[model samples]
Target: MRGWITFAVMSVVTLILLAPIFNIVILSFQGPQTLSGDPVWTVDNFVEIFTQTPVLTYLTNSLLVTLGTTVFGVVIGALAGYPLSRLRNRFARGYSLTLFVVQGLPVIVIVIPLFVVFAAIGLADTLSGVAIIFIAGSMAVTCWMMASYYDSIPYELEEAAWVDGASVFGAFVRIVLRNSYPGILSAAIFSFLVAWNDYLVAVVFLRSESNFTLPIGLQYFFQQNSTDWGPVMAMSVVMLLPPVIIFATLNRYFSIGGIGGAIK
Candidate 1:
């Protein structure tokens, strides 16, 4: 009875969360002229988005930035986390606190300064520039996340590997990381979301139409076609797909491991 009650409550919460997403899917199918009318469904909005807009360019830019952010964020986060997890000293603690402080700082607070620096360095208006910005913005949180996950992992596994003549880095790569798929996936998704949905930094840094990521391009499309709810919502759906696909694909790899069992 208690389990059923818990399931019922969670089902209700799930529906509440999914309501807006379902609305977007519905809106994406409605014809522009009938958005507020009888809800006539058509593929016209999807057709127009492909035929009439540079959506492929926007998609490419978004993929580049998001992929770059996710890859770099995960690698750096995992590498940096090693020291924080294994080292039980003041320096490591101080660095971990620094990461926490950086993570707590709002993006808006640092974006302007970053813009000035990027402008001076001629990184403004480039996809690579936007990707670098995303990497920097997501790095602190990624570090903290990876560190916390590493903290949960017992160090005995690495010590066992060490006794087998494995170097610190090799033991980390082979033992610790093999057990950290869930944490890595979480950080990857977080970085992907940050780069995928970013608008403020993209708007400030990217001026060229060809360099615009999907979020910025979507905003422009909405501003120009404010009354056309169909295509607007279609673009919203497009923006939602990559993260969904990523989570679905990587979720299978998320599980606890028996790294410590290897020792005894």
Candidate 2:
């Protein structure tokens, strides 16, 4: 009876969470009949979204920024994380504390200074410029995440590699990096999503229509035209695809495993 009750509760919770997503899906497929406050179904709106909106451009920008942020974040994160994880130095500890504090500073609070600095340096309103800012913004969180992952790894693996005619770099490659794949991929996803979802920074720094990311572009679309619910829902559905794909692609690495494979 308890198990059945728990199952009923879980089913209700799942439906509640999925309701909005289902609404979006239904709304995306809705057509001219749906326009009259009646829920009608058709594929035309989705077709028109592809035909009409500069959606591909916005999607491309999102992809580019996500890729750039992920690479920059993961590479820098691993490098910075390595020292922080293994070092016993006071400076490293102090810097780690400072990094945590910086992470707590919300993105909205920093946009003003970034705008001034980027414009002065002539990086404002450019794709590369957006990417650079995103990299810096994501690096602190990435470093902390990577450091935690590294902490879970045994230092002895690195030591063993060093004993086997390996330099620090070689040991890192052979031992640490091999074990860091899941963590690296996870960090990449986090950074990519952060860059992709950033609206405030994009709004402040990106003035050109061509450079506008999907989030910024979506806002512009809504602002410019009378309410076009069809294309709006279609674009939303497309925009949500990346995070789903990324999480699904990376979820393969996470699993329960026992050392040397024994049932305890």
Candidate 3:
């Protein structure tokens, strides 16, 4: 009876969470008739977006920034994380705390200074410039997350690798990293989402219309067509797809038995 009650409660919560998503999807299909109280479904919103808008360019820019952030963020996190997990010195501990502090700091607080610096260095209004911000913004959280995950892994595997003539770096690569797939992927997803959903940073640093990301482009679309609910919802749906695809594809790689099984 308790199990059934819990299931009922969870189902209600799920519905509540999914309600807005469902509403957006329905609105994306809303045609002229639906707006005028006739209620007919259509793909005109999608058609309009592809045909009349620069959605593809915006999508491409988002993809470039997201992919760049994920790659640099994950690699840097793993490299920094290994030391934090295994080191015991005062500097390591202080650096770890610094990461937490950086992660906690709001992006808005640092973006203006970052803009000044980037503009001076000639990186402003460029995709690479925006990607650098995403990488920096995400790296602290990624480092902490990867470090915590590495802590859960037993050190015996690396010790054994050392006995077998492996260096510390080799042991980390072959044992720690090979087993830290879930952590790396989680960090990648966080970085991807950060780059994907960023509006404030993108709008501030990126000036050219060609360099605009999906969020900026979506906001511009809304500004130009405030009453066009269909395309607005459709773009929202488009923004939702990459994260879903990423989670779905990487779900299989996140297993529990990589190094733990070998430890015993």
Winning model by lDDT: 3
| TM-score rank order | 3, 1, 2
lDDT of 3 by residue, 1-264 (tens): 999999999999999999999999999998777455886789999999999999999999999999999999999998998889889999999998898888888889999999999999999999999999999999998998899899988898899989999999898888898888889888888999989999999999999999999999999999998987999898988988898898899888787535666564
Q: Please rank every candidate by lDDT, starting with the best.
A: 3, 1, 2
Cand. 2 Cα-lDDT: 0.83
lDDT of each: 0.88, 0.83, 0.90
RMSD list, candidates in order: 2.1, 3.0, 1.6
Listed in order, each prediction's TM-score against the native is 0.93, 0.91, 0.95
In candidate 1, what are the lDDT values of residues 73-156, reduced to their tens digit? 999999998888788999999998898788788889988898899889989889888899888889988888888888887887
Evaluate candidate 3 by giving its C-alpha RMSD to the native, one decimal.
1.6
Residue 216 of model 2, lDDT score? 86
Model 3 lDDT, full chain set? 0.90
- Scored against the true structure, residue 216 in model 3 reaches a CA lDDT of 95
Among these predictions, the greatest TM-score belongs to: 3
- lDDT score, residue 97, model 3? 86
